[model samples]
Target: MMLLLMLIADLLILSVHGWIVYKTTKIECFPNARYIRNATCGIKAVNRYRSHTNMESDIVNKLRNVSLNLQIFLRNSANKFKPFLVNVTANLCSILDKRNFPAYTTIVMNILKEVSNVNHSCPFTHPLSTHQQKRLIVKNLYMDEKFMPIVPPLGLYKIDFNFLEGYPYDDVGTVILYIQVTDVKEFKLRTKAPKFVYSTIIYKTLSIECKYNPEILTNVTCQLKPINWQKSVCIWDADIPHSLKNISIHLQLFKIYGANNFLPFLINTTLNMCDVLSKRSFSVYGKILFTILKETSNINHQCPHEEHLSLYNLYVDARLVPVTLPLGIYKAVVRFLEGYPQVFIGTTVLNLEAMEKRERRGKVNKN
Candidate 1:
């Protein structure tokens, strides 16, 4: 009888523990910057809540010798806030390089990696141009409970980020973030969804231009026309010579820095067009190219001695733009080659721009 009673007790204990674990869904941490102040020349600091729960910080200008002082305050029983946890000051540059204070540094790096274009290395340099600045910061902001290296006890907590610069450590800015931790059951019963905003990256194409060699691919025609104020279509008609076999394509991307100067940004790579078309090999760049052109063009089948190849009224699908490219003029140079020697058959230079997407309120507006 005593053994049976002990078994009942064990079952009850296991059920209770399981219930507790199941109820604790996730840790809820939200951020809010109360104020931001910058007292240096050629620097701008702004902080505001983009939504009810998402906070955004926009700091323009390069940063060097930056130090960060972090403090955590907890609400106490006496209805007062007191320092209950960490209070440490560390050089931001050193943390980026050597990863000091790993517990805290991990959080900082995770946040920056998600929201901003700041490099993971030291001596942080952000985009300076107006269009580049617009693309640097993204709106989606939320901390996954699993990402936290260590979760504090459930309570109301305030975190202060004090930024300092130079040898004397002159104050650069301060940003305060508030956090609340609650049981998953309570969170679900009280909230409709996770108290975080998520959005997809959107971009608009400005222009496109293409060029090719007349001797190799005769009767070549390329044109871009505006379908509407916000949309455009590209048309290309080229005659491929019968002798051209085992073709390859080289793609290079350049971004305009200032004025009309275009500097190399990404992708100076070559791919075998025949392999891509014959489904023998599918590379990352090839997949992207196929995704963009598959729906509107007739370049899906295997390659050999070709006839005529054409793309008719091909629209640049904004959704197909895989990454968040900075707003500005961009040049894509595509070179078609023939045989193993890579004799250049044709060259096409495409000029385009990535622009911010405008919100649709009443009438559609262009940005």
Candidate 2:
């Protein structure tokens, strides 16, 4: 009887271990805000999402205070995120003075070491620049897989970092961060194919509008016309009297949320058009533009333009776009600048919509 019970206990332990090994968790953290009251110092904080998430905070200490107080609080979705689960407060300057830290202080020190340049013992006299703060914060704030503990229950978590100063410990500022934990099993079940498969995207141009400075570009004409039920073309013609020695292009993509309300979408970039034309360097969006314009325009040539330029029946190929973009109404603004001081010479605005190929076909048939 004893041997049989022992075998059953071993089987139960193996089952639990297998379950933990198979299950995986994903954690995403994003900055919520940084609020500071009336103070002599200045703080600038920004959160951006591009191909990846980035958070930056710049602190300008004009007062040159040596001591600082840091308070951390963690809240979860158990009580609808109303109450705090853990509250930790410590004197940062005092902690820096200690050679050996207690168990609770170790986690706080570890986090500061990973995210900032406060490795050495304090008195911290040197001023930290905005560039240095941005580099350190954005580069090192991500959580590593090895450092992640066992998967907690899937929910939303909020962490608040409150900073205080002076003898009375007045509030200086607060930086809020939100964390979301999700299970990989649900994600796998929802996505049938890979996330960025090119064949899945089907974008269509709805309209195009062009504006140019009459002094810079003369005899300008731009229009968009439908070739067939499935194809459209954009035609552009312009004349330039003086040679453009240097030029830059700024491209921004906005997703239309509601009537007359536009929110910035994935793509926003400014690059040297001359460098791209000469093939010196190209970004992902630049590559897309180059691929589309190479077949129909004179944009592939190097800089120094003094004559007429024309793009006859230039087709906007949807295949060149990033497949990760969702189906929605989108607007793209392209601005052209010239010379060293960067004078805005022209702008092109395109209103577009993305839909699945089958949905587009169905709409055409219904029309």
The best candidate by TM-score is: 2
Estimate, for each residue in 1-367, the C-alpha lDDT of model 1 and write its tens digit: 1111111111111101111111111122222122121211111112210111223233444456777666666666786667643555667677667656433555555555554454355454344636443222322344444344223344556666666667897665554544454334443454355443223324334566665666678888887877765567778878877656688988877778767787755446677888877777656567667766577777766667567888877765656544445567778888889887767787777777666556556875777
Off by over 4 Å in 2: 1-199, 359-367
Root-mean-square deviation (CA) per prediction: 20.4, 18.6
TM-score, per-candidate, Cα-based:
0.44, 0.49
Cα distance off (Å), candidate 1, residue 364? 12
- In model 1, the runs with Cα more than 4 Å from the true position are 1-205, 359-367
Give per-residue CA lDDT, model 2, range 1-367, as digits (tens).
Answer: 0111111111101101111211111212222123221212111222211112233333333212222322222233355554222243556555556643422344445545554454545433224544443222322243433232222234445544555544566554544444444444434444454432233445667788999988889999999888765567788989998888798888777877758676755445677877877788645555666776688887668888778888877765665643345667889899999987888789999887766665333345644
Clashes of each: 0, 0
Model 2, position 267, has a per-residue lDDT of: 49
